[model samples]
Target: MTGEELGRDEENTAVAGPVDADGSAEIGELIGRLSGDDDLDRETRGRLLGRLARLLGQSARKAGAAGVARGKWLTDLLVAAAPHIPIRDLETLRAHHHGLIGEELADSVVRVASNGTTAVGAAGGALAAVEFVAPPLLLTAPAQLAAETLVIAAIEVKMIAELHAVYQVRVDGTGTARGAAFLTSWARQRGVNPLESGSLTSALGSAAKSALRKRLLKTLGRSMSTMGPFLTGAAAGAALNRAATKKLAEHVRKDLRGGADPIKPLPGGYPSVGPADKP
Candidate 1:
């Protein structure tokens, strides 16, 4: 099927179930907005998160009925949502982080994202004990975990993109190209080295998409480990998420610190968008 036809089907399958809250936005769109939104206060963020949890529950049930978890479905939603994630350019990054440069700026973004994802895990895990007592809530437990998975993924993707900017290793291309590169970076938990061959492909080709789907599945498995009695899920989820984020940050930061400087088209010319499409 063509991209349009496939997307249409995915959209139908994605939104097949009941409305989670007042709005009609899909899971990925919500995640795109929630990722690294500096303006959102805790209360507003909490409300949006509730909506996301309910939506994930609905989507999970619907997809489960159809067949597998639709890993492709989740991957497509996130790729489409990537460009919409609010990432600060270097100037904005410095201003927001109080003129932080180099490692300082990278550290601030990593810490904030790690803390935020840890809190997301805790909130999702808080329902673990009740899930066993209530059948309805039990069904939602996996959904909650799925929601946490996607949100954490979004935050990490945002962090990866921002860290590149902080390190002066710009991935030059259209918004879509850049988004795919960053998404791939997050999927592999590695920094983008523009000098590498096909480092910033126009999109996630078949091999790249498969790798991303697998990574996402692994992270979801980590979320599943949080389900336990006696309210242990919360603690487990928080610790796992914090550690994962920190580890990813360390890996990406190391690669960026050693990678080539800002990307410049070589004589052979790497892939690039036309001038009109430049952001």
Candidate 2:
């Protein structure tokens, strides 16, 4: 090559090396900006940390539940068939309910159940596993489950209200009357029964709310650094319940071929009788 061409090529090579180094440095800086630092402002750090924590908790819960569901398919199968393999007492139920809902709401339900001398109950011990899992996400299985249950409950109430519309039942009192009216109307439109819907709503609502409170109290008992355990446990439990429920519903739908679909709405708002209702 000519001298001038060779010189130009050498200069070009020298310029390219620094440009490559500069590009690498810029990429490193961008990564640093994305990650931020411990010394970042409290609000910014907290928000980032919280988001990371929640993401981790959700992932963990989903994984854990899937593992548990595979191992205990038989137990889940039994629970789906009978809907009452593991019976829980009032206090135990209270705790589960708290986890599903929140403290105050669960407490209210407990008080109401106690006053009427009516015992509230739930099906399957899968939720117990959930209580054991979620803690990292600042939630319990019951708390997460409560949201699902509320969706179920609202559907039940709507069904009952619709039923009342069909029967021409004028329910105009307080408490039970109101509940009955709502439930009746809810069931009719939903093509279910008020009593059945009411039962599921009561059971799920009670369990989720109780579980939530227990988690909060446990978190409060620990120091800030140790709070991760509570949040992790809660997230784990919620994830476990979701997976277990899905598995159980699938098994039920496959094995139990009745008019009742465990994953779908029952004739009323009862615990999803078919696969369609599985969370």
- Candidate 1 collision pairs: none
Give the per-residue lDDT digits (tens) of candidate 2, residues 171-268.
32222223322322222222222222322221122232233234323322221212223344334433443333333223322322233422223343
Instruction: Quote each prediction's TM-score.
Output: 0.78, 0.20
Every candidate's lDDT: 0.67, 0.27
lDDT by residue (tens digit), candidate 1, 58-165 = 655665644337477566556655544667777877877888998888899898888878877776666565667687667676666667778888889888888888
Query: Which regions in candidate 1 have their CA more than 4 angstroms from the true location?
Result: 1-24, 37-46, 61-67, 197-201, 259-279
> Candidate 2 has what TM-score?
0.20
Output the number of the TM-score-best candidate: 1
